[model samples]
Target: MEGMAITRTDMLSVADTVAREKSIDREHVLEAMEQAIQKAGRSKYGHEHDIRATIDRRTGEISLARYIEVVDEIENEVTQMTLGEALSEKPDAKVGDFIVDELPPIEFGRIAAQTAKQVIVQKVREAERERQYEEFKDRVGEIVNGVVKRVEFGNVTLDLGRAEAVLRRDEIIPREHFKRGDRVRAYIYDVRREQRGPQIFLSRTHPQFMAKLFAQEVPEIYDGVIEIKKVARDPGSRAKIGVISQDSSIDPVGACVGMRGSRVQAVVTELQGEKIDIIPWSPEDATFTVNALAPAEVSKIVMDEESGKMEVVVPDDQLSLAIGRRGQNVRLASILTGWDIDIMTEEEESQKRQAEFNERSERFMEALDVDDVIARLLVTEGFTSVEEVGYVPVDELASIEGFDESVAEELRARARTFLETEAERLDTRRKELGVEDALAGLAGLTPAMLVALGEAEVKSIDDFADLAADELTDKEDGILKSFPIGEQEASDLIMDARVAAGWFSQEELDAMRAEAAAAAEAEAAEAAAEAAAAEGAEEA
Candidate 1:
């Protein structure tokens, strides 16, 4: 008992030095030392024995002991004993009690000391890793300054003082190179706990990296007086940032450009001289898109809001400039404005519009049994299909230039007759295709769509119910591919078929729809709020 506990002031001093060096709590270092001593004690004694160790926080006194369980039946001779054996040692000993035997101070041999050192080093490294991860995880999305520790095959490893971050080759800007001991600035894009360790991924070419750089250089942006709506980067080549100022007196573009271009120049140098277009962000997609494609004039823009698509018509000579080198300008604008843009010259757009007009006129001439002159008049008045002529109000059709009420009624009658005849033909073809009646009863599947589904071998309700929305509406080869119905409507039709096939009860589907609608409402609200703060582009 006299020498069972040993005190060493040097132990406390070692813990203090290691804790300070590793930036870990001193108590954690002491705990690691206790584990090392426990392993040493277990090595000196039998390895199977239950050995425990502790160190007093104030005095650095180490205590080691072996515990044996007092039980009705002995499990092992080393760690367990029957109650009769324990009664001889202590009168108050009972079952489920642990009889601890204090161990004597262990003399550290070379092998034992080496094993203890390995344990201590491993535990300390683990503690250090936890500390680093906790400190850096929330630092993601912020720009960090670091020193280049090494460069391997163009991939850089930056030493961020307390942590290491990897800036992959793909994440580095073109023409940017780093050597060892060089100071570099990067954006912390992601932090993940990998199997090897906590990996912090950095990027120099990320769009937000440019935005963050501007935020650092421009005071208005940092203070939230000027808002950066969107940023698109072609890294080391060019970029466009859309900005909107909350205050009318402050022009966002002018503020970002700064006095004498000082603020913008600072960012430009950091980005390796990537040309930037600080455009004004407009809530109108076409206007903003026009601004995004600067240094080139746009003649016209046509937008299809439902499809989020745009066609931009530029003068034939300005096409190259608007498209930029390798279509980079338009691509960046598309990314900035969130639209898929198709650029065309005025001649091409005019020719395309003429072709559409001719197609509609021919369709009207055939469907209404009218001459080319009358068909052209109807097409000029915005009639595209027989269905439109059939359903439009007779008075509205009569109000068209040079058309009387009797002529309008006769034209609409011919359109309805043609549509009825087409429907009969489609129904007959659907029947000929072996499409089932149960599938015909499903809403949103027209006679034409049913024929297509039948040709694709999805005739029965069960067959239709098993298909996904993409299979029903895929633009490439979906059964209803020719129809204008979107994926959501296709899914609803398929869901209805599922209900008909008894795959799901109506009540369950209703509940699911209610939940989905709620989620969609929330998502739409968030998207609208974001859109209000952003811009969109492209139309011809």
Candidate 2:
């Protein structure tokens, strides 16, 4: 014993037997029995149990005896046995179970009463500890229904039928609360036998709890027609469950979801309204990734299986819906599927190919003196440039709005002769201007910017040169911000601009031309309005 020695032979034997049956060390039993005996002895016997008891190591024998009074009539009954009855019990004329049938000289009032009380208390405590140890030792991982007794420091104490258990805060799900005496069902996480008592740890937040709930509710899951392939949970918030079917006719998702989502809803309700996504499990990665990004349509799924990654393309309108708020949908899907997912839009693909063809057509249009709308239309028809419009796809060109098939075919035939005839007429003009070859390599800018500049009459390098710095700047609001080029590029670009006057300094010429034209137009409009007003006055 830790605090006292067990000298009582009967007690020592009983402690050894208890230790053997309980699979505990004999020393542990001895220690527990010593405490019980001490408590009983101190309260009842005023000091301690005086009877010395010891174990017989070889024989394993336990001998016990106590003294009582041999009297004619029993007055203080606990300390005495009547002589006539004592002789009948032994049949050898003995009046005591100890040695002599004679009363002891000790007093028998409060001291005896106290000794009796202590003995009863100590025995009850030992029995309770043993009962608790037997009750809880085999309960680990099994579910138990209990009522909440009280809460302390965020740990809930549950009153199980035979023992109490503790559900710790970390093992509890968020936003879940239990009132006093509320029935709670939890898994027995662990059992600990301590000096004071048996301690049981309960859990309500384990992943297996979800699986257990499904097993209880869903018949297909229990019967193995549907198996839970994997489960990933952000408990009390959301959970993603992957399931597969053994029977091909059975839909695993439908089985787990139940009719009208009742089975999943029951599980969700138990989890305090946490949402669940039941995705069909697949051995194929692409198929699994598509299912993982549920509630959104995927136009195409491209996989890079080496990196275990996949890209999903949605229609332009569904891009935001697929990725979700702050990318939470994709993020959760990545965790659930174990794959990185990326989304692309349809508009991005169309714009990329269109921009490539426009870059090749700039020079062809400049040589032919053709407008951009005609040049781009020809490019789409697969004429390499405006100069090669003879073999254009007339059917394709006619498909573009407002152009008939006959008109498209006629444009193609006229393109070649027009270029040849214009070549003869503008030969000297082209030589002086050195415009024989087309300007190539004009990518890194959109066709929209080029067309807008043309609408503003800044068509060629000579036309751009005719504009002054302020004249070009006044063409558009925040023109520099609108243009993608930097300061040095813009500065070099304006040097090539020119006007029909052949002035090398086109900047000043274009600015003066713009100011004079605006003034003349304003005066003519005012004079017309005044003439109309005078005619009205004469008529009146």
Candidate 1 per-residue lDDT over residues 157-263, each given as its tens digit: 99999989999999999988899999999999999887678899999999999999999998888777788899999999999999998889999999999899999
In lDDT terms, how accurate is model 2? 0.65
Model 2 residue 105 CA deviation (Å) reads 15
Highest-TM-score candidate: 1
Q: Candidate 1: which stretches are off by over 4 Å?
A: 1-7, 69-97, 393-395, 398-413, 420-442, 447-482, 487-540
Each candidate: RMSD: 5.6, 31.4
